[model samples]
Target: MSSNKLSAVLEKQIHHLCLKDFPCGYGTWRKTKDSTEGAETEDTDDLLDLLSCRHSPWRHDKSWSPQAPALRRLAVLTPERLHTDFIYNYFTTLRIVDKGVSVIDDGLLRFSKLEELVLSDNKITEIPAENLPSTLKILELRANRLSALNSLTNCLPPRLEYLSLGSNSLGSHDDIFHLTGRHWPQLVCLDLSDCEFKDQRALLSALSTLSCLRTLVLEGNPFTLAPSYPGFTVDSVPQLSCLDTSWISAEERQCFRGLAKNSDLIVDRASATVSVGRARGIPDPLMRVEENAPDFPVVNYGYFITYEFLSHQTVNLNFDRESKSDAANVIEDDADLQSNRNCEKESCKQLMVYTEETCHDVTHVSGHSTSKLTWSECMDFSHTHTYIVGDLGGLKRFFNKGLYLTIEEEKVLSWPAASEDVPLAKPSRPVKEKKSRKGEESPIKSGSTKDKSKDKKKKSVPELFQDAPIRRILGSVHIPLHSLVTGGQKVLVLCNVGALQTESEVEATQTLEKDLGKTIKEDKKKDKESKQGGGSSTKQKNTAASKGKVKGGQECKMDVHTDNSVSVQLEPVTVEFNVELEKWQSASEAHQLLLPQHNSLSKQPVLS
Candidate 1:
């Protein structure tokens, strides 16, 4: 309230408080003023001494009917007293309380440079935006008749930031936006503490759009009375860091987001982050490629055959004793091959090449090609991640090495043999032969074995491993089979993962050990016989030298016999891969045993 410029609306006489030439007030209504004292009235429509104009006080009240006398008086005195061009440039602020200023009439608009205007407890119904000065910033229109905010949308000063429209019926989202909208982009703080609104939803919906809002006061409003109101407000308006007097903290936001149910009155963040529309009825990758795709041409066909096929193709087909042409036709017709000449369609053959015992790279879809898979591209929808937890021994035995485990192996590995009380007995060592005092050798038995073998039935991929402590396996999840670009080329692969052992694995191991023991016994007998034979041969040679004598130029001769034998044992380890709806079949039977049976954390209502 600096008095740098005087604010006076005297009666018929001017005050002589200082020099008679002191500067005039905010509005120079009259050159002269009176010192007569008067009491204020209750009815605001009644005229007061706020202006020097001589307009009849009775004329201000439009409700007064039969206004013939008031109109007659206003026509004569207005020309001599009221003038619109007299700009009140001296005063920076003007405070007039209960002055009966029903409208933003000529008395206030004359202050073209007015910065601060407080028109409290008045009958001012509305102010047209074009009448106010742009230089005005702080506007206090509290306890006034201003109910609607529509008039103040652009009427306020362009630089006005802090506005107190409190205690007014200025409610509703439509009215609220008149102040919070683009017209008031620089408004960082707003005071609508007691303002009325349609509902909490309507209010929050309007406030959420103002991304620039930093502080808001809504304490006395009806919308702020709900349970978890602080949470709802903070979450509904992300930009609002402070509400009323309470400061919104990171911990509060984290806590209230889940606890508050009203926040989802609008699902904005979900709609913004992911496009759920794309995931609906999405086609599988394998379906896009035809099952009977023509093989791609190999430019260097002869080079491929010589290096890739001819060198590797050592197996001989035992065709029946028939014509050459017939045998050729029979070979081509055997394996459901499109054509025997088409070698490019060799992926199926290679699929069953690696067995459980022989693990290979899972990355390699072909000898020369790798699988194409990026996590983001493959996971088009929601996903659940699983962490594997089991013994290291279980995992080591689970996988052959680098290849994916076969279905049987995966089943055995997944099921725990720990269900059985008896442990698997260790293999016995072969008995060593006792050498005689004479140091004689024994004859060795020839065991039959064959190698150039045909592909046999695939053995179980999972191996029996010793029980160990829990080994946490992280990032283990079943990828939907359709997502793979290998065209549904999935195989039983061995992965060294700690997992439960099954009854099948235990039974299979017992059978294998029995077979292995018989083989070991036969090997021991062969070695013992071979040693005895060597010992007898040496003894005979010694006797021949001692009993027989030879003439002086005759060379001594002796026959030393040795038996040589070769054996090969071939094991079957190949299996057929079904290609019909392979993707759907794998997904339907995907692993679910490892998933947690109960998740209390997921059911929690708030973030800890």
Candidate 2:
């Protein structure tokens, strides 16, 4: 321990140790107390000394690997931070991972011999180019909130070859140009993976300029999510030696090049590649479009992905509420309403929102789908089938809670994978009695005890991929849609159409509910008469009457009327799909090198 430079304080209280003695391949990875205590180091001020004598990136060539000067490695990953800066010119490699760091002290500028610096898993926002030692060759800044690349202009060291800016908020279209290799002519690898990049064309355009780049990572972006992604990426960027985590295959290159020639042919966007496989029990790191986001579930039928959710309890669109009158106040001018509508769209110009047209191509990786339907807040029940109307009872219960609660969230929506032609297996739908109430009262029986128990046990899910985009789109866009029904079909409706509960809606909801109740009562009368008079003969006539009642959203010319707090009377459109994993993928071995391997002495963290 003394030969390894343990500080006097650490030599005293350190109960657990993971030391990488010099001239060794790997170090100990142990904790004394057990898993509950976690793999955490305390008061890391003494950690700097432990790393001072360790040489990282042990090379085949005595003097070097392109990673760093084949010697003098140091990593101080103590989350308990104390000193702001320290001068250590003798060390060639340094890592300060997850040390609650916010600022890089000027002391690092004095590390004239430093070749690599890792400040990942910190709360840093910007990396001032001025203070970085010009002799440094690599930098890792993952999991930060960095947005500006202009700060790095002309600040990169001349020999810098590897850089990682993954999991940051560099989503704006303008940041593409900042990635060029003009500053570091010797640049070889770049990791922009999981950054919020939606436009592939712009990203590819900027990447092509890096003539020296051999490796590129663009995973977790929406653009690369399509089926033709791998092939197209290999086709467009001929210089890439590696795309994402995999090497550019010669067969994949030939395949996509031929497909690129024909424009009229629909590019079959399926089954091109898969995500890195996850090792069991070793949880994959969480990646998000933005930190702490949420998502709505999109169930993909055989060919359609259905995104279903309900509206706010009180939709305050206030669209048609110019007057609150029994006094017969004339409605506002059409021009005034139109102008206000235009203002709504304009005011949301700055937020990062997804447009319908843009999101249309956003494929849910679970399965291939061609169409989707969205639901809105307000819906009229009079037009729907008797069965769909009954489904609204659950919606009423949900809306009454004044929160987002729906049928889709009852179980874990895991997509393991299945054939494209074969639909994903779904839980069996309980067969309900063939009962109808003329589109008035509830039709569905409460589900099985097992299902309700399972639902109750399912804990709140943590942040996932869909949550990232969902939160982004929901943040910038106003209004809501899609609520619960007996079957798994989603209802599509318009958001802006919901206005304050007007006299029309109040009167309409009341009249519709009464009319529906009468229909149920009348149906019973007909059934009784048919059973008594001519059971078999009148059965066909009764069935016809039930089927022909009414259907709306453009067909029956039925009035649209749903009160703010009334039971739901919405339509259900079925979009069938099978659950499939977007093919779970783990980070590449090369990606693991993005930071210093503190415990691996033989294999120091280095660009491969």
Candidate 3:
């Protein structure tokens, strides 16, 4: 057939194939003209038979050869027939290529229209800089052996946004810095999280220049712990809005409090130990505000912290939508001020120190903000002799030795009316009923009334001493005496002999009693020696009688005389009691009372 006729037939077949569904097993055939001159000595019938043999309309076959001049305009080609001419013309917009094709050095230029080039998960490692089309926006070369980004220095498109070079053996930040400057100006995100960097300074310098960079994820890098490393400070890079430093898990929002001032950056131990204020080279901003004001607003009155919400017009502070209405209501409520005072008193009932049993509201007593530690204000008193706060279930776990006491408890214990000699009172007794007197009761009224009066006096004296408020009990088994001493708190351990049970308790009681007796006897001897060298037997007896006697296994009922009108009766274990004149007197007395006695019976025996 003529060249013009063959070209027309080829175009018709190509058009038909293009319209059909892709990868369809369809075939077409056409005849090619002989290139050699004077070779057509055969018959027309022979040429027709050859053409008929090459043609098959229904089945796919490679009859229309791409090398033929008639089929040169075809855009797509198979891997076996990928020629330079085919790539230059038809594959102009092609951005993706499958494996098994070794056409890397094609001489075509200007692939500026392509956006994404996904050559990832492939064996192609080295990319020639000049070969890459400038129009390429994304180059995904992840999971390949890319030692350095030097190859991409000249080829990196300015508009490249996302570059995933993950899982590659890219060594250091210096290796990747070759792709910096105008080459990657529009690049906003870079994932070099797990890439091994010998020094982060290169990365830091490179990142410092990426003014448009919004997010940076640096995790699993060894140089992250290196010293002299200035972290991602917000002040240093104003455009860096988000940074994942691996200090906390990604799931937590804004982990690690107290970032460097004037910068959103967090400083760990690897960084310089500089205070936020000092690092910023200014006094604390909050302190400056307070210094400007005449007086700092009072948060707590007495024992309770109260927030006074003035008129909404007075304060022009802005709050989030959720809290705005509530904030306004708080300011408008006039009764809240009065209720706050009442809350102060009522809230004291729930106040307690840490113990074995968990006290959830101890955080409240410790003065933590409510938003930080979310717990009910009410104290759980079900667990005996124990308190807890937050997740700590024991008092020992919660508090280190410190003088912690509720305002009310402190006031009651510090009363001046409490006496050391008077015994503590038991709880109040139930009321008694008066018996009705019938007709004969009037005859002997005076004698009966006198007898009743005497009985009442005897009963009242015991009741008064027995039912008095217990100022302090020293040797109660429920209370941990050793814990109090070892927990770093300075406390007075007062023991009463009456509370002793076992032989160990008795020995402990006797040891305390003998020490008290010895101290009293020594004082008396010193007094006698001071007054005169010699004293009469009667005078000695009188002096001995005047001085209080110290006894073992007996509870001393002392009336605690304090400044307050309410008198407390203190029942000390195993020894006579005396009022503490000075603050340190109690501690000194306890120390003296714990001294070992000489006699075996008076000495503290070994406890089983």
User: Model 2, which residues run further than 4 Å from truth?
Assistant: 1-87, 258-608
Residue-level lDDT tens digits of model 1 in 508-532: 4455555555645554565556557
Report the lDDT tens digits of candidate 3 across residue range 174-252. Answer: 5656645556788776666445553444556566677667666554343433222223333234455565433223322
| Sort by lDDT, top down from the best | 2, 1, 3
Give residue 446's error in model 2 in angstroms. Answer: 33
Global lDDT scores for all candidate models: 0.37, 0.42, 0.34
Instruction: Report the error of model 1 at residue 578, Å.
Output: 74
The alpha-carbon lDDT assigned to residue 392 of candidate 2 equals 25
Between prediction 1 and prediction 3, which has the larger lDDT?
A: 1
**Every model's TM-score:** 0.30, 0.37, 0.28
Q: Which structure is stronger by TM-score: 1 or 3?
A: 1
Q: Where is model 3 poorest over a 10-residue stretch in terms of lDDT?
A: 271-280
* Candidate 2, residue 104: lDDT: 61
Question: Which candidate number maximizes TM-score?
Answer: 2
How many steric overlaps are in each model, in order?
44, 14, 42
Cα lDDT, model 1, residue 563: 9
- List model 2 lDDT by residue over 228-248, tens digit each: 455556656778889776898
